[model samples]
Target: MAKQDRAVRTRTALIESAAALFDSEGYELASLSTISERAGVSSGALHFHFTSKAALAEAVGQAAVQRLEGITRPQVDDALQALIDVTHALVRALDDDVVLRAGFGLSDSIERVRVAAGLRDKWQGWVEDSLGQADREGALASEGAAQDAATALVAVTAGLETLGRQDEWWLSHAPLTRFWQLILPRLAEPSRLDVLVASGSKGGAPGL
Candidate 1:
């Protein structure tokens, strides 16, 4: 039991260390030796857990996928509001979690080698599904506005992710708030507009 626990800890540490390195320096530049060193583990141990850097990267991507799944898990009552909440949660994760950030970064960098879908693709699918649900709920302003809104949301969020790489302020709730405020009037039914919070549920709260 103790040996299994130790192995689990070692694997987790390696993944985290690799995530940090991958987040800061692109996947091609982040070396296995450096990741092992950062994790305070030996190269032999790292090899035992993951045979190759690509395998380790794939593991990081899987970890990121789990985190992303948690973010888009749809916990709210309203579909539209759930979409808003997901965006807020995703930005927060991207800002704070190196594994998520690196997972997204690796999605683009190692597209050919990756066996699973990329984070961006997964996010876009979620947005599309959420918008479809909103349309079904009659929350949208028009009949076909869901598709347009999905495209806009994906584009804007992808842009934010890119810009965030340079300045973390891009990942803040302010920009997303402004975006929702501007788009909600057009995307949502007038009746539903007032009920939807653009800045998110956590916005305006102390220390948020």
Candidate 2:
């Protein structure tokens, strides 16, 4: 293999191994040696790819964010819908134990504080933008409540994550449906909520 490809593969291996270990053992208890051994690479190679366990944890969190972005980027139709869609998509992606661990662990890591803050800002931005669009499109029912809705949406999703299952990894379709049922009707074109409900997809986008 080319040197670059080989290096990338090794990095992938290290990240995957570290994600699994961190998920199962928690960040403090998971060791570099265990991750390096699981990846079948020398500690030196692991160090070359990621300088420390905290670095590896940050990488895992970043990877989880990337995976979620892939599923959600095209799924949002407007601001509120985008918030709903992306939040749902994110919750769905957490079906994996590694993602669960990374997300759960992100809350407690001082080393990854910047990453956590960036993630929060990203979500908040998306929510605010979507609400702005919904207002432009005349699809917002609560005329002056965009900011409040965005904040509430974030809070609700966080609560859902805390309340939901930690193991077994799949998104609970039933709970998701219930959430939609409750939120969709509050929109401007309240009757057209069926489009989202029937499609079971966001943004009414194909290939999502």
RMSD of each: 2.4, 3.1
**Residue runs of model 2 more than 4 Å from their true location after superposition:** 75-82, 97-104, 165-170, 202-208
Residue lDDT tens for model 2, 72-153: 5645555455555666666665554465446455655755644543555565676677777777877777777676667777
Cα-based lDDT at residue 36, candidate 1: 98
| True-structure lDDT of candidate 2 | 0.66
> Which 10 residues in a row give candidate 1 its minimum summed lDDT?
199-208
Q: Which ten residues in a row have the lowest lDDT in candidate 2?
A: 198-207
Candidate 2 local Cα displacement, residue 133, angstroms? 1.7
Best by TM-score: 1
| TM-scores, each model vs. reference | 0.94, 0.81
TM-score of 2: 0.81
For model 1, how does the per-residue alpha-carbon lDDT over 126-162 read when each residue is reduced to its tens digit? 9999999999999999988999999999999878888
